[model samples]
Target: MAPVISSLNPNHGPPTGGTAVTINGSGFTGVTSVKFGIVAVASFTLVSDSQITTTAPAGTGSVALTVTSPLGTSNGVTYTYSVGPVITGLSPASGSTSGGNTVTISGSGFTGASSVHFGTASASFTVVSDTQITATAPGGTGSVPVTVTTSVATSSNVTYTYVNSTAPVITGLNPNQGPTSGGNTVTISGTGLSGTSSVLFGSHSATITAITSTQITVTAPGGAAQPVSVTVTTSAGTSNALPYFYITAPTIAGLIPTTGPGGGGNAVTIFGSSLALTSAVHFGSAAATNITVNSDSQITATAPPNVGTVLVTATTPGGTSTVGLGDAYYIYVAAPVINSLIPATGSVSGGDDVLISGSNFTYIDAVFFGTAPASFAAVSDTQVVATSPAGAVGPVIVTVHSSGGTSNGATFQYQL
Candidate 1:
């Protein structure tokens, strides 16, 4: 048996077996059989005494190709099956709280893929071509090996990890002030949040509905609550703590009326919580001489003096609550009303003494030209002598604050 062997022109192909390989050498004419390793060839054509074209077989890795003829057995020619399709890289390793991501796998030898796996779970894959594959990822935890299988063999490990990325945190909440039987929806914020399992206000579990990567809207749970820490949990882990407070709506615990002066200079105290930052005290239609927030539960205000019934209102962040009718005070002084003033025009540069005549002047405390203070002396129950303060020469409001409620501003003038 005399024969000569050359080589396989093109030796590698898909595992599905569709590639033209040319074996070139002498004694190929009377060839009886052509073998791709142990696998038999599908078909072949002897182009010449030195050329024979055949299809490559299905397998993984390399194999030798040979042809047997009546003349002799041809020499073995190298034919590599090629390392089957591999998973080179995966895009987004993590998905959403909803979970359903179509990912791409890039690598070589993907010509005849049969199946794709995300961890042990099988994923639907589409062979887009030779080097690209699109597959829907299955529900999995942590990182798992991604593999691709062909008619020949399965490729090894590729990393694809699932993660819960949500940042749900509580910033500030109301009633600072809710009942201990918690049922308040508190707004929470942060980032990277999803698939939340639970929300905790201290040890109490808050019911949560809307959970996102940025925020979690939750209803507070009941407790011996004042202000407590809030936490959220996911499959990955629990979140950091935040503070929430529960407070009682402010109440007008009491008012100091009997102790307050009949002339209205006396400071009246109020007790309450959840008080608005700027709570005003009013006596009848007239506001107090001075109002001050002592704390969440207390306010000290000067009663506006006038003999009549008055109501005290305690306002808070939640809403407003009134304690008593005439609870603030029923004083015995006449409210000063600006009737008229003589010599109303004066120079702001001092040296101007003007007569301010109005009813109930005995309770007059001080007069102001706009915001500028002026010195005045009580001339009688209806007269006041005041020197205008040095200030910007403009139309001024001469107010007469007194033991009674402040008078309506009397218009005056300041000459340059």
Candidate 2:
């Protein structure tokens, strides 16, 4: 009985055909030949009595495909060969020369596409469907014809354009210098800042906060002391580097005799590094009266009138010193006064506990009995208990000395 052919897998192929076709039919073993039209297939495999696989030779148009075994020739099945692929359109026909742009191609006969080209450059491509292909363009310049080549033929129906890349330009930076710890926002102005991929300070990368064609805002990254290059990168290219300075914030290591009167007229010497460019000195919220940048390590500033303990800060172009780090402090006190004295008279033997009453005596450093130093204990903010020293039989004045200033003398009589 003659073999009966039912179907052929992939009934169509390119005209320059090398397509593998699977024949499904009722066929016995010992298949002698498989033919497409009058041409014979050079390579074929008989998997079973009901299936045969064969390679189609180069041909064009539709033709009768048949299998002939020792028993009888199989009934003919039809197979058609396709023409070349045709590209109709290209999405994003223009891109930067730096390349890495995805272009979508819409066309017909795109199935089994072998190669895609942009001018003389070969592009990596993927066939999405019979009518679509997505390609990643290679680096190129100027306009180029894009083509898709199949086994049968190649089609050139679209043009891809390569535009000259524009490098980013930096015009200026706001608050150029910052603390080494770095979390300050810096506004960078320039051209071609749009689509920025990276913002780098020195070798560190900054976090981008906002971006525009002419401006970009980014948070600075921590860096060492010195100047570093700041640059922006986009798809086009890297921009010219701008200088960014990483400065250590001014520090106040010591304040000479860190206490003063509430009237605030004392010149306090500030000792620290990074003080050369001192712009402002602050005592709490009050600005200093006179600020002198004595050197990079020292500053002389007049303490502003303030009360209690206040933080002192030195400011420069880099940044201001942080408050409450110790060392940088000034305690403002009300000047001590001589209100009265208990036991105003004492024996010349110099053994007497005199209770001195006054305001602003909390920090008393010394007590004097008629120009002689005496032992004293600060009883409170307004009182000091002092031992009167030996003196000649006469009227002696007792006084207290504190950071607030020396108190007025109170008359004390000493008996000979």
Alpha-carbon RMSD to native, per candidate: 16.6, 8.6
lDDT of 1 by residue, 90-154 (tens): 76555543345677898876778888998788988899988989888877777788899875458
**Per-residue lDDT of candidate 2, residues 214-332 (tens digit):** 99999999999899999998767788988988888888888997899888888999898889878899999999977888899988988878898988888875678985455887899
What is the overall TM-score of model 1 with all chains considered together? 0.34
User: Judged by lDDT against the true structure, how good is candidate 1?
Assistant: 0.70
Q: TM-score of every model? A: 0.34, 0.59
Model 2 deviation from the true structure expressed as Cα RMSD, one decimal place: 8.6
Provide the lDDT at 180 for model 2. 86
RMSD of 1: 16.6
For candidate 1, give the lDDT of residue 118: 82
* lDDT for residue 388 in candidate 2, whole number 0-100: 90
